[model samples]
Target: MNELLVRSGGLYTTVQDTGRFGYYHMGMPPSGAMDVYSAVVANMLVGNPDDAGVLEGTYVGPRLEFTDDRMVAVTGADVPVTVNGESVEPWTAMRVGAGDVLEFAMIRSGCRVYVAVSGGIDVPVYLGSRSTYTLTGIGGHQGRKLVDDETLPLGAAGGRARGGAAVPEALRPALDVPAELRTVVGLCSYRLTEGALASFLGTDWKVTKDADRVGYRLRGGSLDFTEREQPFGAGSDPANVVDLGYPVGSIQVPGGDEPIVLLNDAVTGGGYATIGTVISVDRDRIAQTKTGDAVRFTSVDLDTALAARRDRRERIERVRREIAR
Candidate 1:
């Protein structure tokens, strides 16, 4: 069978597609590529479906040897990629033969890198997705991060993939600048004092080491909550409220100090009072941010949020047209 022999599974490597849906009510978050735009572009470069399974490597990247000829593309992080010790440009599709080894250098900017192989990663799909949710161990390869010396199956490659297909520089997401996350200030936001809300938006929060697929914990300025009697079933902490469902991009400030931006693999519901939600498209910006990176939240209206999503869709469509040429 066609396969990739994992020489080293980097820091945290896993298989992920678009995401799993219809299970959030069961407390499962849609575990997928943190930078969906990058992941999709990687797949497109190799002529795979937009939601095709790809390898997501965090901080570091995996070393793998191909067992058959395949088309490959790497995206997301600004990391150096090498094929059999020779450097190669990222965001471009390249052909690899059996015995070809692929490797990555230390990340220069973004936290995660996506590798898309032609025919996609052939792992058993659970709940309509190949995403890995490591917390409960449900999907991906063995429901956890890939380990050293493991073998991953690959699907049959399609004939349409063209080597040397590259995404234009303008279309690629920028990794050099601090992230400015557009947020919709609403959900339970009344809990915060006026000064606290302003602080949350104005401060240049730094991403803490606790940032991951589940959530990104940030530290910058402290916030103050308006005093109120603790409601029944709610914890004594001022940031606590009776359990409420958390959207994928919700921001929750625990202890009125650090704010956690919940991501693809975050909990479905929690007692923490969510101050606002980062717009969907901006989640890609936050995903590329590494520890110590600065980020600021900008409050925007719902119409603006929807417009951003539309713009992203158009961008992806442009990529599709470009790669087809």
Candidate 2:
């Protein structure tokens, strides 16, 4: 195994894979890389498994010195990275020799930066993922964030490094908001009051400061729901609410009427009524939003949603075609 000695771990760092799945029934949310698309791309660049153990850094990235030569890629946030004081671009794979010092500054645009090493992080997996769920204290480097002096072991490079993996120039995914967010009106869409659908689809919302892996509390004009007799016995797990099975990406609006977009690490069950769910294609955009960023949710019918999915799939196919050429 190779070694990456942590010299200076920045703000918050954690080992993340594609995330835990099929365990939400046991009250475990899929807590993995926030930018799963970018993370997968980075891993693909280095020929690692799409769900390999990568580093997810918030606010700042970490500093590491390698024990052997290896290829690594960084994606997601645009955190200024440098190797021995020389600047390096993210989302591209590059070689690093032993004793090379890699450092990263705070995020400039997005929120999380993913660093994928050549042979994947050599951490024990739990519940089918290497992600850290800071709340439940499971998986990922002892179920916690990275700290200084943590030397993580890496698997052997396996002697394959002929092709350089660069972030596709045209496929640099945009994460900015105010762009229309596609949504499949939720299981609870019919509960909204008259005109509520129009208001929700046309309104602008800002992300509040209280944002994290758990959920995003959006600020916008109140979305009224036709009041009805409340149900009983809903137990909110992980976050503690009346029990109602909560799906990831479900936008839950409590009595306050503001929608809260649930993310990967969100609770399994909750009491708040979920009005809409941000479509999978739009989720990456939502992940990059920050406080006060303007966002608008667009209503896409089943047909439109299917078409959007097809368009994205075609884009991925195009990227593959270009890669093969």
Candidate 3:
């Protein structure tokens, strides 16, 4: 069997696929690639299935030595990639011989970087996914971030990918600018005063150090909740509501100061009142943002959100066509 030797597992690196579904009701988040678009694109560039398991690296990245020939692609963050100490272009397929070492430099912009090989990472799948949910120690390689000197198994190569096949600059996500997340403002929005809602939208929020796969805590402006008698079964906190399901991407302000946007690894339910939900597609935008980055939310209707999803699907299709050539 083919294997990848980890020379240095920089920061946090995990194996992830599309995501595990049909289990969210049991208190498990999908725990998939945070930047789904980049992960999918990297898989495509390497001729792997869209859901093939890939490596997701946090602020820093990993170094690996290949045990066999393979085609590899890197995407997501704007980070420098090198093979055996020589630079290679990202968002493009590159060939590596047996013994070739892959490395990454400090991130230039985005938070996470994705590396997809021609053959998917062959970690044992659990609950219908290869994704790592580190909180519970299930799935992925031992259900945690990679450590140096660990060996990972790789599946057989698909043989369709060619070195130098590239994703066009126009199709790649722009990481240099502040993210403007399109949100469907509703749910418990009635709990906030009009001015508070306005402030929530108007403020340019900065991502806090608390940002992670579970949620992004942002700080900027304070919001005021409408006064109401605490309901039975609800906590005394003004932001508290009866415990309810939290849809991924839902925004909840626990203290009227920091708004947390829940992501793929967030809790399934909580008592906090969710003021809105960032649209599914825009979650990709937020995933690339790092600590200290600025982001703003734009209110939109459900129709607009669906349209944005369609646009992203079309873009992925375009990428498929482009890489096939």
Worst 10 residues of 2 by lDDT: 234-243
Count of backbone clashes, every candidate in sequence: 0, 5, 0
Error of 1 at 113 (Å): 0.4
What tens digits encode model 2's per-residue C-alpha lDDT throughout 143-235? 888899978878778635435556577786786657567888876666677687788888898888877888888888777666555545643
Measured against the true structure, the TM-scores of the candidates, in listed sequence, are: 0.99, 0.90, 0.99
Pairs of colliding residues, candidate 1:
none
* Candidate 1 residue lDDT tens string, 55-102: 999999999999988999999999999999999999999999999999
At residue 49, what lDDT does model 3 achieve? Answer: 94
Provide the lDDT at 62 for model 2. 86
Query: Model 2, residue 139: displacement in angstroms?
Result: 0.7
Candidate 3 lDDT over 1-325, as tens digits, reads: 4788899988989999989999999999999999999999999999999999999999999999998889999999999999999999999999987899999999999999999988899999899999999989899999999999989999998669978999999999988656999999978999999999999999999999999988999999899999999999999889999999998999999989999999988999989999999999989899999999999999999999999999999999999999988
Q: What's model 1's lDDT at 90? A: 97
Looking at model 3, residue 5 earns an lDDT score of 89
So what's the TM-score on candidate 1? 0.99
Task: State each model's CA lDDT, in order.
Answer: 0.94, 0.77, 0.94
